[model samples]
Target: MFTTRPEIAGTFGCVSSTHWIASQVGMAVLERGGNAFDAAAAAGFTLQVAEPHLNGPLGDCPIIVHDAATGAQRVICGQGVAPAALTVEHVRGSLGLELIPGTGLLPAMVPGAFDAWATLLRDGGTWTLGEVLEFAIGYAARGIHYVPRICATVQTMRPLFEAEWPTSAALWLRDGGPQPNRLWANPALADTYRRVVREAEAAGSDRVAQIDAARRAWYGGFVAEAIGRFVAENEVMDASGERHRGVLTAQDMANWRAPVEAPVFLDYGNTRILKCGTWSQGPAMLQTLALLRGFDLGALDPMGERFVHLVVEAMKLAFADREAFYGDPDHVAVPLQTLLSDGYTDARRALIGEEASLEFRPGSPDGIAPRTDYAAAVERARAAHEAAGSGEPTVSRLGASGGDTCHVDVVDRWGNMVSATPSGGWLQSSPAIPELGFCLGTRGQMFWLDETLPNGLRPGRRPRTTLSPAMALRDGVPWMAFGTPGGEQQDQWQPIMLLRMLHHGFNTQQAIDAPAFHTEHWVSSFWPRGARPGKVVLEGRYDLGVAKALQARGHLVEMGGDWTEGRLCAIRREADGQILAGANPRGMQGYAVGR
Candidate 1:
């Protein structure tokens, strides 16, 4: 079997990301003596510049970090929370709105990516805030290649900018917008970084103090002030097909900070897989593993219908539980222990049949009946999704259909590792803030309007997000850091690759290179939330017979472009100190660099 690229191996360090430039920047950081945390942060900020159509400064990021010396692993919760004023009564009763608008100011959460990176850098990195930030600042101030996707996404939002978002129009519409492969820059965003660094440096020379001060500058000072003013001042059109102002405020930003918490993990044989807490959909992969443990997966061909169908069925069950049980642990009593308990998984495993199951099933956790408030609407949406051609990839589905995401993975010589997925605040997500040069994220759109459900829209509760980053430890030691950028497909694709790598004896690149698939049977986490009961998007690289076999088993299979499935990046620390890495080749932009 052929692989897209060689699995990068080195003893020094390795960094992989969705964009090549960001990957190189992370490698440079490691070469300059920074740890995995520092390298990830540098790459993340650079991605905001180079891949603005995918992520922005105000986007959310969930990071999994392992410190080799202490042998401790933690997750940085960069997913922001809804505003205090954003309540069911406010939207439904006061505004006469049924659902949270998927775009514009109303759905803006307290932007969380900045503080999340700050916490990572302050806790584990050896670099200063200015040092980690300089890479992004350079690209934003000077220039970087404007990819075609970025140009097209901008064009899609052109009408919105011209009509209402004057600031965005002025910023992006300059020089007839940006042509593909042309050098483009965002001076306003660069100046924002400079002001942040200046204010942070004014606090003194201590590196840790500067990181903290920089956090303050974003959440409490200039960045917050500008964002609050813009959201309060503008009432813009959104996915609801209506105009509305935001509920987010400067106080919301000031009151919020990213928290680092112990990660949730499951022991699958000798492998201990770690994921973010219930606040994210990360544990869905863990749940999938728990369910898959009952099967003899190693006995099946990974590329065969048996494997794909089994995995797809398992994911539908896992994601069903995601919608029913996963939420902010801070806000609800998520019976996580029971959700992953042997008894529960054993029951879930029993539900999988030789044929694909179209029924939406979420098992009872601790005898509590799972509640999906919009369950009735799911079928109607399923039809609509089919009629609307649900198989289209995210970027093509832009403007409220959905926006894309980015991922990064890094491992240092000391064995410290980081896996992060950063997303939201796409140029199409909302209007740009003129002063700050970025828009607020639309993560609040993920919350359901019904207060009875676990993921209902509530004041200050973090939306049950789909931004998941993952890692795995072997024999009680940190080993691999990996993640992808396909929204609900994140966990699905991750487990498939892990299964291939662990069971089929495939290398990292080979596993990533294999044909991938994911189910949209569960309700989407984005705007116009919908589900296609038996829909599975399969990469066309798979044998055509596999598609026929799946369809015979009742799967509503959609054959996607051969190279249009996932953009995963991964890095692993081998037992003998060798660092191995792999990046997705589908997009022709992802890269792995080391040595």
Candidate 2:
């Protein structure tokens, strides 16, 4: 079969990521006999240096790891929570704002990526704290030949940096923000990493103790002090970004740590797919799978109009439920078991008709009423039609503020594997802290100000985030690790890749290189939230007849450039012990490397 690139084949190890440098760094760790956890941690830190516009140290990550030694699959919750002082009254009453701004300081949350990587290294790997971070520190101190996309983003944000955020301008606005031809270096970031290492080594040579010391340095010591001062001194913002003070503090950062928990999973045929809990949009994928099992997926052509229609219709239902019920289970009671029960899934599946659904139909699982602010939703949708866009998209520029996410997948020779999606704290997300050379993320924008819904903004509550990673088990053993870097589009692309592999006999690269599609029918997860009913965008490589067929069925179809959809990276270990990997070829940026 023809593909954009050959499926990488090996028995030793495999690593795939949104950026080539991160993948190479992960492979370097594996070559040195580090486990998958160590490799993933190394790669994760390198991503912050290599793709500063896409992710940073202060961002969030949700990781799924399959450990062969314990015969277990575990999830590390790298997602952060809102500040204890960021109450609904503070936003809606005192700030006199109905919605949080997409940019600026008000939407900042406790950063979780750094601690998450440290936790993984401590609990699962044999590498030292200083060893994994060395790669990222080297790139920052010397120089990196960055891609045009990063250069473009820095230039675009230069004005905002120069005008309102002088500290950011000091770093990013120099020489028009890293020229496309020259290598750019971040000396401040390098020094920051070096100082952390010094603090870790001060705790003695024991590996676990050193890792714990580094965590303290971030959350309680120098890093936290810098963030606390910066946020406390800054002003809060409305949608217009003009007034108020930031609520984040050192106390919030110190109070939080990345949590590890068992993942919820479903087994269909010989494959068992696992995802994070209802706190994320992950369960929506499981819901789609439960709904699709009744269909004769094998009989339908995976590339034809029929397959696209069935998948899209099923996704609409699943996402509708996501908006209605999914949230941080610690604060709210999410009916997950009822939502995934055989009776509820089959009943919901019966709603997919030949005609498209223009209505937002959220189901009533267990006879519970779906609580939502419909009146406010309609108003927000209308304002969205007028407001210029804002959110995380991979384009050179988008909306009021623009940024994207990053993904890494690694499989080691020891039968260990990891799939992680790390994102937020982009260059445009907020102004940088002068001392640390990074800023906080705007994931708090995902919370509803209504204070009544499951995803409402509450102090110390986790916002319903779009950052999701995925893993799969074949028969009773671990097999695939894969994910992508699109906000709502993360889960959409993976299921299609899996279906093709499961039924059409497509290899890893073939599945990743195929045409992709997704719906934009739900409420926006970013600022100026909007809803576009029955809208679908398909990669133009798919047949024109498929688009026309969908339009005839009352679906609004728009054609995108053949490569405009998603950037997915995947790696799998076969029962024969052969390792295979694949990366998206759309932008010619993502790389899959292995021996």
Return the lDDT, model 1, position 119: 93
Kindly list the per-residue Cα lDDT of model 2 for residues 1-595, writing each as its tens digit.
Answer: 6799899999999999998999999999999989999999999999999998889999999999998899899999999999998888998898788887777778888989999999999999999989999999999999877888888877776656666667778888876679874688888888899999999999999999999999999999999889999988876332455755678899999999998989988776799999998879999988888889989899998988888889999988898899999999988889999888899998999999989988888899989788755456656777656543554321222215557899999999989999999999887788788778787888888998876789999988889988889999988889999999988888899888999899899889999999989988877787766678888999989899999999999999999998888789999999899999999988778999999
The clash count of every prediction, one per candidate, is: 0, 3
RMSD of each: 2.2, 2.4
TM-scores for every candidate against the unseen true structure: 0.97, 0.97
Angstrom error of the Cα, residue 10, model 2: value is 0.4
Candidate 2, TM-score vs. the true structure? 0.97
Candidate 1 on 310-380: residue-level lDDT in tens?
A: 89988988989999988899988999999899998998899999898988899899899987745655754
Q: Model-by-model lDDT, in order? A: 0.89, 0.87
